[model samples]
Target: MEIGNLNDYFKFFVALVAVVNPVGAIPVFINLTANQGIKARNATASIAALSVGIILMVVLFTGEAILRFFGISVGSFRVGGGILILLMAIAMLNAKMSNIRQTKEEELDSTERDSVAVVPLATPLLAGPGAISAVILHAQRHDSTLHYLYLSLAVVALTAITGLLLFLAPLISQWLGKTGINIVTRLMGLVMAAMGVEFIAHGLKQLFPILGAS
Candidate 1:
């Protein structure tokens, strides 16, 4: 494999990590599952992680098709998605969850829901719009089955790490504390903002070839 391919893989993974911000979700996870027993909590974590994996995998494979069906070009999507991610990054920088991921109503609804695993935790929290857009953009990078398989593995590995963190949410929360979590979240936000800018720049180049000529 070319070194550039390896680098792309690494970049893709880092972008996903930043967009997902699994560690940042710990506080929300803890609060959502607070009333549950250890076994229940673990189950919730597993389901959430699995849901994330499945959701991303589906998006990785079919996202392009969906975009095409809507007559949307990748360049246009990158600009739009980049803006969404940039907004989320701004929120992250402030150590706050973006309403784009989950709205105030959703957060309130999550508390009363019977199963928070698939709804708020897995959908918007762990695999929200930013995460989905990141996956779709990466999917557009290569159109090979092997490449898709490799990306799939990366998704699986990421979700596994996320699951482990969620399963150990209490310990992580205690260790990091609120201040530490906020610190980490802010760092992630910085990374995410860079990624968003990169996406928008690349997209603009694609959309307006004149930009690339310069």
Candidate 2:
């Protein structure tokens, strides 16, 4: 690729990173592996990254079929994703605890011990519905196979880098401090909510001719 094309891909990668908000996930990772040793924490991070990467690749490659299997149009998916993003924003804005927080209760309630990697860390935390939807939408926006490949690779690379960063959760948390983390989370929440609304509005305009005409 030419320098210009590479720059474009870089921009796309950056946007995906922002949407994924891996840094925002650091706190969640810390909480999830609070009891684990360093080796366990590292293993959990590796598993989480691999799991998330696989999910995104699957969504990118087969999202259309997956949606069709459920009889869902892209427009419908966008609307649903918008609602989810909005809810996440509301939780962030209100400083409400996430479902990952509830995992602690589940741990206390259950005798079947599970690896933290598979539960709150990997599922709803890393490859959550919002992230999956974003990946699908990103894939849909690409027209060329080359572009898709570039974007897909970029997404994976960015995700992996983010996961690696999160592996240093203790250092990051200390660097950000409590108040700084809260501020960053709220800012990201606002941005995510806006992005969600924009996706919904764009989908509505595309799917509904009357709305577009108006």
Candidate 3:
């Protein structure tokens, strides 16, 4: 089941959106940059988005080799990553941020730091574990360089959309308010949960071919 078809590529994009949930991260971006000037905030947004794109692209291309170095199969990693993403989705569904993405310590640390565009905002916050895992798992579905290129493009598109959202964070925050943001988060959470389950199911089937036969 190579990611040669448009549907598969679209699913990859959707999964990235569901897990990334840029809309859900708007409030965080706003709060993190609240003390900064408009220009500074915009700069932060641009840096964060660019950082996310770079991180995901690197992971997508090098992830399999990293797993091989650790002697971990894609199927095993999928199950582990699926559980992590599922936990995140549950937190999102409850309209709360997951500690898995950023712990209380990290949040506090960000507040004390002068620059947070790359650390909390970009790394663990935007391009965190679930996002990286999603890229790796999706990359495993490819059999050719063309498919890898398509996946890389998808990553670019995801970051582009996220960057745009962060750039409009203030306006989006004013428009959505807390309640609207929470509603959107919950909806995205539902989608994330579904994707998490799909990852786990596929991983299980791969690890145990008998399950696929059944």
lDDT of each: 0.93, 0.71, 0.92
The 10 consecutive residues of candidate 3 with the worst lDDT sum are 1-10
lDDT of 3 by residue, 98-169 (tens): 999999998898898899999999989889999999999988887688899899889999989999999999
Off by over 4 Å in 3: 1-3
lDDT of 1: 0.93
Estimate TM-scores for all models. Answer: 0.97, 0.83, 0.97
Candidate 3 at residue 88, lDDT?
96
What is the Cα-based TM-score of model 3?
A: 0.97
Q: Candidate 1 or 2, higher TM-score?
A: 1
The stretch of ten residues in a row with the least summed lDDT in candidate 2 is: 95-104
| Error in Å for residue 8 of model 1 | 0.8
Q: Where does model 1 exceed 4 Å of error?
A: 1-4
Best-first order by lDDT: 1, 3, 2
Q: Any residue pairs clashing in model 3, and if so which?
A: none
Put down candidate 1 lDDT per residue, 1-214, tens digits, no spaces. 2123767888888889889999999999999999999999999999999999999999998999999999999999999999999999999999999999999999999999888999999999999999999999988987877788778888998999999999999999999999999999999999999999999999999999999999
